[model samples]
Target: MSMIGLVDCNSFYVSCERVFQPRLCGVPVGVMSNNDGCVIALSNELKALGIKMGTPAFTLQPLVRSGQIHLLSSNYELYGDMSQRVQAVLEEFSPTVEPYSIDEMFVRFDGFAHAPLLEHARQLHHKVRRFTGIPVCVGVAPTRTLAKLANRAAKKIPAYQGVCILHAGSAETRNLLQKTELGDVWGVGRRLVERLALMGIKSAWDLAQANPKEIRRRFSVTLERTAQELRGVPCIEMIDLDEARQRIMTSRSFGKLTDDLDEIREATRQYGQRSAEKLRRQNGLAKAVLVFLKTNPHRQDLSQYSPSLVLELPRPTADSREILHAAGLALERIYRKGYLYQKGGVMLLDLIGADRQQLSLLDTPQSDAERQRSQKLMDVMDTLNRRMGRDTVKLGMPTPGAAWHLRCAHRSDRSTTRWDELPKVRAL
Candidate 1:
């Protein structure tokens, strides 16, 4: 009954990098993953250079040395903050908003007229660009599937100016669907594409015209729903509740290998802290915690070794203290006397909301006051660190000089936020 709009940012990671450093404008820059392993984000210029995604940095050494491709380590904090800003801007448009991913969102607009939809979309685009400097493409349609298709078209079509609307039962919309490729449609994976090709359903319009009953019998309920949604039948409803995460894992490769138990414990503590933060943000609690340490899996000449231990909590909690305690105990049990460990991580499982957790009568239960106190403390810590920059007040467990710091050779100074690292610009 309502129109769905899918708003997606273009080159999200690259755009985040450009936000802080305006000098990088029009440059072929890329953000690399941990260990400077590979290019995870590429600017439009770099994409034109024929550098494909997942290409290892070692292979791109020539381009780097030639000054053709600028590279920097991943700045997740900046990207995350920018994502929050974008979502906040989106919330101003619609009452119901679903943050689909780091760079995508879905909004439901019920009362907006067809003529004004373009104006509303244009205003949203201008506001986002003016405020955050991130360009976005918007797609509007009667259903989510068509919305995604319209989004792709919005990005591809120059006349739309980064906004496309596919109205239900419109001749123009039907013609666009007929011309659209099936692979571009949401929920149509490679296997489904092959099967659909066999059935002569090459385009979105063809799939929409196919008998829903036959499609359901041959493929799956998901494909049938996709077909139905394509034909203007709203089989998929907008999800208001946030999707629960199936598993929460925190792991990182070390800058250098070590066999020190204290280093391992420190790494485990940081991982647990990160996992706990994620759990709390998702409104979930973990009942099972796993700690694992491993050596480089690729090194064949050395004796390969890895060990892990799982601990079941007395009760599920999103508290960092509880998760850190469980993780510490697991690390103590799993860490061997002599094993070269390169990385360690914490995994939280069996997640549920704290209010829904079943409590034990015999075990010590956290009172409402204690729960509120813990939440307040965590919230304060999160706010302070986010406002003042990360690691402003880190736990003592994160030992210094464990050799797990990212290889950020070209790190930008926190000139605007940090008191000590102010930037120096010389005047001529």
Candidate 2:
């Protein structure tokens, strides 16, 4: 039986903030989304206070005014830097650590059936806490779905002490499944829940004992695989780091609604820079560029327009300038007056590796010297930015004030990334 362990950071963004300012420990806190618009993360205290995720920040301003709750803007630079530290600690414990998300990872067992897996998990938790100061829950089981259950239980139940292990095909695993709700099971959505409830499959154990062929006929093969995994059978494979994505997109909602085309153009340039960077990192080039703009549909009084366009490139390339130019033209074709656009983005589509593409018939061929120079220039820019910091080097993207930029008014100091922001110390 294959044993899989999942480690999940608790309220990741909130935990990242508490790491440096120990004063925030046990305090009610929330991390807002782009534009500091909504609460995207909540600490335990905030959760106990009935403050739910995605609640508008304006609605919670009363709590902040009363000093009962505090809010932090989404400081991705700080959060991402902290995530790297946590991953470094995880790598020490497992050679097969698969990062499922920024705050979650799966560790597949190599040969640890004979070892004290539960004890090992406890030790891993300590090391991570000491190194990164982020609390995590660890769950070990025969499959990924069961591990997810165990992880949830570890976090919710005080008895688990942040680590829970369920042996493959063990009696404890079955009992745990009986207690787990169908809604809580991995891959079970609201639609699946309603269908499963009608079939009298209220819990994971019920689904595990259901007829697999019937489930497949009624639903999807994916659900059938979930039932098998619930029965201590391996179904979901670990994700590959280099897996090709269907499309690459980078976008964010603005701080406030705006109809200005210049500001929208600047947003596209920023997103284009990011998308092209990701394309180059993946060793792929895109044959088409996509641009999308969305306006607030909730306001019935105001004219709302959400338009998207796709334009094929003259030549497929991962060059940021080329992608931005294509995106600009697409925006020009689709942009309309009189609508307050709230969000925009750029997408790189129809990706293929550079070595695999055939040039367009109308494309002007690049000279070998010109191609070499372009490649060298991009390499140098990427290197400098990596060495200094993100976007330390720019490609015509606005560096100064832009009205469409995300608002992080209450952002914490990026102590780890900035010199002046670093914590000060004085001799007593």
How many clashing pairs per prediction, in order?
A: 0, 0
**TM-score versus the correct structure, for each prediction:** 0.89, 0.93
Candidate 1 achieves a global lDDT of 0.84
Write out the backbone clash pairs for model 1. Answer: none
Clashing pairs in 2: none
Worst 10 residues of 1 by lDDT: 410-419
Worst ten in a row by lDDT for model 2: 359-368
lDDT tens digits by residue: candidate 2, 274-391? 9988888887889999999999888888887899999998777787888999999999999998889989999999999877878556545455455567667778878877777778
**Local distance difference test, each candidate:** 0.84, 0.87
| Candidate 2 ranges with C-alpha deviation above 4 Å | 359-366, 397-399, 418-420, 426-428
**Could you give candidate 1's per-residue lDDT for residues 110-216 as a string of tens digits?**
87888788788888878888888898999999899999988998998899999998888899789889998888889898888898999899999999999999999
